[model samples]
Each structure stands twice: as C-alpha cells, then as structure tokens.
Target: MTTTKRFFRNKRDGKWLGVCAGLADYTGIDVVWWRLGAVLTTIFALGPILPVAYIATGVIADRKPAELYRDNFNPEEERFAMQTRRAPLRSLKDVHGRFRALDRRLSEVERGVTTQNSGLAREIDSL
Candidate 1:
C-alpha cells in the first residue's frame, strides 16, 4: 500500500477510531505492536513526545473519507503517517461510539429481512 493516510481514524470492527487496528491495517504490523510501541514510547519518554505528537497529529493527519477506498491502497504510508502523526483516538472503546452510530442502519437491514418474509406470507395468504 503506497498510498498512506496522513491521519485517518480507521473503520475497524475491533473498536475506537480503529487507530490501532487501522495502524495495524496500514503498516501490516499487528495492532499489538502499535499499542506496545505507543505505551513504551510514553513510559520511557515520560512526558513530552506523546502529548506533543498527539497535538501535531490532530492537525496533520487526513480524515478517512470514502475517497480513500476508491482504489486499492497499500496503506503503508497511512500506517506510518498515523503512528508519526498523532493521538488518532487510540482505544477501541472510544471508537465504539462511531461504530455504534451504524446500529440504526444495521437494524434496518435486519428488520428488512423479517419484513420481507412476512410480506411473502401475506402474499401467499392472499392467494
């Protein structure tokens, strides 16, 4: 994946802006690695880098719009861009809010299936 996202929250099934998974998705690195790295960086550096990087990424990274998936992207650049970029909302719990928003749409699909079956039964009864 040559095309990288400077900063985008990922649409991951795993959670949060899907930052970790997205990071994993982009770099082909496991999300575990990204999490570990982030924690280690914070622990060792102690104060400045993590906070500063987060602030910078908030400004620099790109948002994940539909446009990104228009073509087959490598996601490698996007991976580094995220790791280098900023906070990207690093937890699955936090990103769950975005995924939660899709609940209505998903329910619509689920409901449609039952409704369709009911309609078929009604049509049969009418016959």
Candidate 2:
C-alpha cells in the first residue's frame, strides 16, 4: 500500500505526546533536534503558546499507522517524499530535468543503433 505524505503522531518514537517525534518524521529532521527546539522554545520564547500548540497538535493529529513505513521502506523514497512536500515545484522541476536527460540519452543510443544498422533501424521503426 502507498503511504500518503501526511503528518501523523509517531507514538512509537515519542517521549510525551509524540509531537516532537511526529514533527521529526514529518520534517525529516532528527527527533532530538525537534525535542531540543521544543524545550528551548517552551523555556525561552513562546512559553504557553508553544505548549498549547503542541497539545493541540497531539490531540488533533492521528497516530501514525504501523504499516506506513513497513512496506517498501526506501530511504531515497523517504527523502524524495520529504523534498516533494517541502518544495513541490522544485521536486517537479528536478523530475522533469531527469526525464529530459534520460530522453536525450535514449535518443543518442537510438541514433547510434540506427546509424550502425539500417535493417535493425527499419525493424525498430516498424515496431
């Protein structure tokens, strides 16, 4: 099954309400960094607002499904998903560039093959 790139509370890796862990999973950052940031923000800056938001997020967000990362758990796929989420247009452009490169390479190969063997080229063209 395909997993949607949606944020879910990672209770399995959480310390308290899974908020920090969830944030880490969603943003592709380390959980420790998220925890540290939350603590520092709570202690120094936002204070009540941060805590309230955390709690609200914990309450509102669904618990991460166990199977979400189980099937086809590729690190590259995860990174791509994170990148797509963070900057969709950039991801799309990157994909387009890759496809264009691949098309150029394939065209070069076809040109080479056709130039070397006219009969093979005719057969390929017929197909």
Candidate 3:
C-alpha cells in the first residue's frame, strides 16, 4: 500500500524558519546537511535566490501536527522511512509484497466466514 507522507516544518528542531528542518524531514537527511547546502548555494552565485526560496518554502510548508510530536516513532516506521530515503522504488516493491500478503490473508478470512455461515444455515434448516 502506498501511503502519502505530509511535509511539515519541524518547529521543535528548527533554527530559523524551519525550511532546512522541513527539507531534512522530507528527505531523511541530517538537518546539518541541508543547512550546509543552503549556505553553499548562496556562496555559489545562487545569491539572494536561495534565501528567497527558503523564505517561500517556510511560508508554503505547513507546521507539523501536534500528535506526531507526541507519538513515539515505531521501529518499523523508522526503518521504512530510512529505506525509502535510500531506495524509494525498492521500498515500493517491498510494500507491494506486504500488500499482496495481506490480500491473501483477507481472502482466507472471507472464505472461513463464508464456510461457517453456510454450515450454520444447514444446521438451522435440518433443525
């Protein structure tokens, strides 16, 4: 199953407007890397454009949900997040496999339920 991940500004860890923090959250990169990259972009004649983009992103991105801050990170979720950062397509295939397994298990449950209902119907008819 493909689930959507919302991009939210990480207010708790942010230094300035949380643009770098948001990018780190989305890309699974260390926040320092993003900050360094922003500085490099500014130095490399990207100039005011980089700062403008950061400001625009800060304005555009939504703040992270309160519940997410409260909830503890599950190991599976963390692993999946890391894997997605490394290889998104590979992780998608892994998700497909998991969904297929779930589908098979659901079909088995439906079959069992149908069988039990039919047996009960026959018992009622005989009685």
**Best model number under TM-score:** 2
lDDT of 2 by residue, 1-127 (tens): 3335678998988998998888877776778999999889999999799999999999999999888755656778777776776677898999999999999999999988767787887999999
The top-ranked prediction according to lDDT is: 2
Worst lDDT 10-window in candidate 3: 1-10
User: Which residue pairs show collisions in model 3?
Assistant: none
Question: What C-alpha lDDT, on a 0 to 100 scale, does residue 29 get in candidate 1?
Answer: 63
lDDT of 3 by residue, 1-127 (tens): 1223678888877998888887777777778999999999899979999999889888888997666663565767766875797679999999999999999999999998777587788999999
For each candidate in turn, the TM-score is: 0.37, 0.70, 0.58
* Over 4 Å off, model 1: 1-7, 11-22, 67-127
Clashes of 3: 0
> Which pairs clash inside model 2?
none
lDDT of 2 at 87: 75
lDDT of 1 at 57: 54
Superposition error at 119 for model 2 (Å): 17
* lDDT (CA) per prediction: 0.59, 0.83, 0.80
- Model 1 per-residue lDDT at 95: 54
The TM-score measured for candidate 1 stands at 0.37
lDDT of 2: 0.83
Candidate 3, position 117, lDDT: 82
